[model samples]
Target: MVTTKLEIHGRVGVIFHAILEHRHYSADQPPESLFQFIDYSNKCLETVKRSVEEYCAAKERQGFFIEQDNLSMFYETLCVGYDWNENLEDHSPTAFAESSQPPLPLPLIQQQQPQPEESEGGKPPKINLSQQRERAAKLKYKDLADYFDYPIQEAARLLNLCPTVLKKICRQEGVPRWPHRKVKSLKKQMDKVKDFMSSNVCTVEESASLQESLNKLQRDLDITVAGGKIAE
Candidate 1:
């Protein structure tokens, strides 16, 4: 078996790490799902390789070295090292493999001067980001408040926030200390969805339908975010 050697450095290393963090999905991701991920990961690594080569050439410093392989090897290492057993969830690969180098001075970015009073490159998105976040937050607040119950103590354990912080939020938001009336119904609905997602229906039509629904729902939720500034 043969493998390639690629030397990445500084910003390029950072870029590769970012791509790694974002690309891999769940442990249950099927073999068929890997083609696209591998393609994207390779493209990103290639771009970073080129960019780092040029940058390091200009800077005259020895860059970082990385072994180029199927990426699954690296990902497997990360999964075992990072404790991604059950849930097989998406987590940043960077958390397991941090940058080896200390922070260096960034290169100065040189940009072409634009004509005075020229319009910005593109029109902004009409949606409001803050509004979108508020919308999402409202859903989360309800989930934390009702599903987990008030003071949000036990529920806070499920999230990154401290119990005290969540309690503060509950108080500040004037959220009641009792579960919402919809909790039982919501739980049933969510359970059904989870079961469906975990099932292997094996029919092409069913798979296509599920994919279509998921895509449409994701688009809807993306558009629902409240922000004037659009995604870049």
Candidate 2:
């Protein structure tokens, strides 16, 4: 499940408070326990940073990009308690040790062999529309939303459908209007349910459970579509 920014903020606050509460240190050197807490805090921050960067990249691929400067400013503001600044130089022994390490050798085996010929005129290869739509047909709207970041145009291109058709699918699938007050709530719920149902099914029992979940989702879609038809 995707965690909200406020939830992340609260987690960081708890971690900071715990560190301060248990802190025991000296002017010349910090206690070993302090190092452990600091390491844990760094891990939490690093995880959040990686997730944000990945999310930003995915959004950019779908024609949306967030400002990096704002993220930088937010990070720096959080570091104020540690007296961090852009002008500060790293003089720590750990930094020196890391910098002294030699680079590792390159991989001996190439995973991807080079294509024999480039596309003519330097243009990208065209997508096989039939194959693309076939693959899309196997995917649920929830799956398509996650893969394409919920942009109607991107999903439409893959599914070989117009924006209006995709919107109709969304309605049949019971996904609320994208412009509603809880804009992300619908997407987040879809992502959570679909991912959970698809993952970690090994035994027959688990497989049956997954099947039941899929059937339920299909039933909901059918009912919505039938109701709409009757209303018309």
Candidate 3:
């Protein structure tokens, strides 16, 4: 199921608000009581408690638990009273994803060589394909660089920059890498969707379905898949 904001905000935030309200409700001593630090702490807790209860009650009324994206504007509404309520809205998707996929012990451990191109010591570890004017390379800014086709000092002079500064700028800007194929593919998908929407050809239902398909594709595929497609 797609993670929804309602499950995050209404369910989790409500429980959090409830527990905090309980603590504030019973806080007569130090540490538990925020009255000393915050003005109208009691009222704040009350508002939080009321907001949570109301949200839960409303959700209970509608059978909204089945869908992944639980429809609820409760978090936005609660944002008026509590400053941190906005966090639930922002972090819900990320929090849900983290909960589903536990992190690896070491991310670097999984990064094995795709296929070693250079076992020889003299050559670089990766392929140096800069000379090739492939379609993939066309998407990058190299054409502009190639237009001048001058040596470092000359190119710097043309751009009204010092050679050292130009080198630094180039280093900072960096060249497009292998995984850039994925960015190109994603951009294509985005353009397709935009074109369809702007053309006024797709019916409302078709538009919604197309949006869903695009979203699913966006979520499921990454650089590896796109790069593989590019290789094929």
Q: Candidate 3 overall Cα lDDT vs. reference?
A: 0.35
Tens digits of per-residue lDDT for model 2 on 63-181?
43233222433333333222211111222112111112221111111111223334567754444434654564455555443333445544454444534444544555565433222
TM of each candidate vs. truth = 0.19, 0.23, 0.21
Q: For candidate 1, lDDT tens digit of each residue in 46-147?
A: 675576457435433333223223433332322322222111233322223334443221222211222243226554323232354344444433345333
Give lDDT: candidate 1, residue 207.
Answer: 62
TM-score of 1: 0.19
TM-score of 2: 0.23
Worst 10 residues of 2 by lDDT: 103-112
179-228: candidate 3 lDDT, tens digit per residue: 33455576578778878866768899888888887876565344233322
Winning candidate number (TM-score): 2
Supply the global lDDT for candidate 1.
0.35
For candidate 3, give the lDDT of residue 155.
51
Q: Report how far residue 123 has shifted in candidate 1, in Å.
A: 61
lDDT of model 1, residue 225: 24
Runs of candidate 2 exceeding 4 Å displacement:
1-123, 147-150, 154-161, 176-181, 184-232
